[model samples]
Target: MKMKLAATAIAAACALPLQASADGEVNIYSYRQAYLLEPLLNAFQEETGIETNVVFAKKGLAERLEREGRNSPADLVMTVDISRINELVERDLVEGIENDTLQNNIPQNLRHPDGKWFALTTRGRLIYASKERVEEGEITTYEQLADEKWDDRICTRSGKHPYNIALFSSMIAHHGEEATEEWLEGLKDNLARKPQGGDRDQIKAIHAGECDIAIGNSYYYGNMLNDENQREAAESVRLVFPNADGRGTHINISGIALTKSAPNRDNAIRLMEFLSEPKAQQIYAEANTEYPANPSVKPSGMVAEWGEINPDDLSLQEIAENRSAAVKMVDRVDYDN
Candidate 1:
């Protein structure tokens, strides 16, 4: 019975591409905010005359896909975080895509080894320091966050956040667990307050003079600057690219993949290819203030304003592989305790 079900699903998928109308729509399960993605979807529809439908949720798209099984209507999945994308691949819910356009556009380190997913945008894990308190060049590396000088002067979001967890995982990838734990301890000792709030809140704390330095994704700075209410929250802090002379800046991505049991495989492939194109990539970068996955596409003005720095070039898979261990270490240190 299991064999028969698998055969039927494959047969359905094989038949889907051939039957998919040029004008057929694609349904997307997006973990990203809808406003950030709407413009690109609109452009895609304008170009292809194919409708684009999306279900936007902050979490659980993976479980949704798994539960829906072969009957799932989702053609594509879009999400942030390497671990989430890896989860889809591990569950056999994501299909491998091979396209010359994708290969030529996205760098190898940013894409999955099996072509299961492709990063669309990149965000640096950067430091934000109080302009009045921390002079330029005072903190130049991520390692400096552990220095005694920053004691009780640093703020950050919860370690449980995927962004921080991924950042910690990258540290483990570069440094051994012992060194990484020691660094975390130093950061903990330096905390202005127990980790609370989102990345923006950390910046708010910096603006309020509660902390002299904070860690956040570069795009959050852009987002805060773009928001009317949060503009005040970002006004006092300046962005810093850490480790510029060493391993390079740590980074992560917002990425997409095709669902393995997609009822609209052809539409899924088309959407993926479309996203890789320069126009779509630019829209993504501009809207989110993230570096485009396509090297040929330049970052938007806001991202460019942050200046260029070499990314660490770490394989995103390394972050995913170390995620569990990183979480364990966070608990071991009683990061919140």
Candidate 2:
């Protein structure tokens, strides 16, 4: 089963530069978009003179690493969401990091317990409510999205999407399975149209009047607002930091991990530490509109304009642990149906 994925992923691996074996170079297998990574990598190279190579793909990376094993040229993996980074740990494809800079930069709750992965930036699972239809303060929490008042007034992407799954997992961590399942069922009952599209689509649905409220990540709002074409759709909605009055907003991360087969271990660690520092964290916040994992680095640009978000204090490890149960609950509710 795994080899099939690896075989298919070879096409992706072929996209990678073959010079990772060379000295003074760090190789990365990234799920992050190249546009977002380019600036950071450029700055890193300019600062340290260490060259970086990346193979960007949406899926099949973990299996690719597992297939390549010791011969793999990948020195590090950069990806978003707790589940993805944790998947590397679960497969034993990555190694635990032992660096003081990494430990000092990322908080305990955002990183793996055994030092296998460290988060770079976080995005809130925000509520995007139609400014015209939905009154301010009408919806304040994830629980409220399931309320009867929102019947046929909500839209979302697939419940199984990693972003939504992380939010659902956090819900499970807070409320347990039975209550969360009930909540999922209620949320499903509230859908305006069958759940469809990505996070940005949910916001666009609100602008189109197909739904009055939707769930999406905080960064998408900023991205849309900054774009020429999507600004109108983005402006139509107000960003709600769900559960700000209670348990706080649920957030997922873009994180990094060191591969077990790191051919450039020292350079990889250098890049990792560099990313954790203020300059790289600032680039992440400004360029990507994401909350920096390092508490010392504050969010900038439109993300900062949204004001401070009281992110849920739940450990990402707990969220990752509960993800399977969350997926099961989504299935039990038949959320995509």
Candidate 3:
């Protein structure tokens, strides 16, 4: 609920006191790991001869930007979830982008209305069930997870998780508070264990026979498939695309935005445009196993193997608007209880 901005482009050349050069250099602050974003940045540098500098952290970059203020050296910000993006918007940290290429490449739902941020890649919140335990057709919809039959057979991360919270917000948007609360209560009763751990841990619990079903994002599945140690963790379970018959699967994104006070404004805009291009989108998909936000880009083989899915067409801003209500509802149902 704490709102802050990620990136701002400033006009002042002497803001940060760092050495400035017109050699086409851009600085980026990212919530994602360096390696995941390195390939694209490296490719951008390779293609445009722009020097790219990056600082990566899982949290606190917003506060860091706020502290740095006009003196902030950051020219661009990249992070996951609508909450973080909304924070940037609320704090007036990100600046409006005027690029036509970005506008054409990104769908309206995936970008800020003011053109401050745009989703680069997406992850879906889908069902993961034990292949040996749960029958293939036994569960399909997210609504069905609340059924009494699944009691003590479900595993999940904490409700406070941004992924779960966002999914919950989407549910609220689709289903009224009363219905969502009822579903949450049922889900809480069906929980195999109290919420804990990341998505991979939930899947690992399923493989361990600790639970028959779990909720997770698509990228974690990809990460598991790619990791030598956790490959076995994904082998015993099947991924299910829920709500295919209705609102479609709930989805979230890892996105980028230009800071309002960006020092290297032209370079930052160029980076935004570069990321929206098909090749960069493909690099994001192939490297991270995420679906490209650009509809023109095909998902990588790993994601394709997971099967095709229809994402909920709801706007990303709707998810941000409903996040607080979703968090309150989670607490009301004592989802962690």
Candidate 4:
């Protein structure tokens, strides 16, 4: 996706392309940037004739919703990370939406038990290892990241970031905090350097010979292949879906929810149902370089080439419950230092 908005243009416009509509409409407050979602939203409008309005921001949509209360124009909230979705639910900002289409389209583990939110796309947290130095079968599970055999060889971003927090939360969900704390300390001991930079930086570190292995989300690999500067660096590493033999690889989602005071409730439901269908899922996931939430819908482009993901079955809610504990563990180990 080539989105070339100048910084001034983006700062002034904020939300782009579509303007807020008066009728037969649904308004979206998205943490997902407009460039990443416009193609899919345009498709939704063309198919359903429902006018869609979006306000995209990097942060504070949740606070805005709370401030607006019943007067809010938001019909749906779409964003990355399960914690953000759960945060909306925790604040009573969104309503439970259980329908035949949503239930049938999303798997049981991905949707909330109360039906307040549903996952639209997923990305696996995988090990990206140097193809030349790291043998294919050298690592098989997330537990192995902490092993002394891999000492001073792993690279990753800050442990407190939501992506890593969610992953560590899953570890706490699967293993008690005591065991998780120990594993976290061990993993810290094995880091190639104090955890630093984003997922792309970890891959770049591998390419630059700073480390033999790095941890990153699945889509970054697909994205790297699209960039001329990062292509060779991306190719130097092989994607590994860890824990395939046991609990399965850790995974995260970008999801959607309906606001509690949606002015366009029926139209929003129509849009939600439409988005949950296989056709829309295919378009949406491919555009975002994500695994479609619907099991029957396959990922497209180079993402498909990464091979299939066997995601862990643990409830995302369980992971959310353990998130605070996970963050505390990270600080206790001083992983980011």
The backbone clash count of each candidate, in order, is 0, 0, 13, 0
Candidate with the larger lDDT of 2 and 4: 2
- Give the alpha-carbon lDDT of every model: 0.84, 0.89, 0.85, 0.85
Best by TM-score: 2
Winner of 1 and 4 under TM-score: 4
Global Cα lDDT for candidate 3 = 0.85
| Candidate number that wins on TM-score, 2 or 4 | 2
Mind giving the per-residue lDDT tens digits that candidate 4 earns over 129-171? 9999999989888988889998989999999988899999999
The C-alpha stretches of model 3 lying farther than 4 A from their native spots are 1-22
lDDT rank order: 2, 3, 4, 1
Q: Over all chains combined, what TM-score does candidate 2 have?
A: 0.96
Q: Candidate 2, residues 251-324: lDDT per residue as tens digits?
A: 99999999999999999999999999999999977888899999999888778889999999899999999989
Model 1 clash number: 0
Model 2 C-alpha lDDT versus the unseen true structure: 0.89
Which digits, one per residue and each the tens of the lDDT, describe model 3 over residues 239-333? 99998777888999999988766788898889889999999999988898899999999886889887788999899998888988999999988
The C-alpha TM-scores of every prediction are: 0.92, 0.96, 0.93, 0.93
lDDT of 2 at 278: 97
At residue 241, give the lDDT of candidate 1: 92
Window of ten residues with lowest summed lDDT in model 4 = 1-10
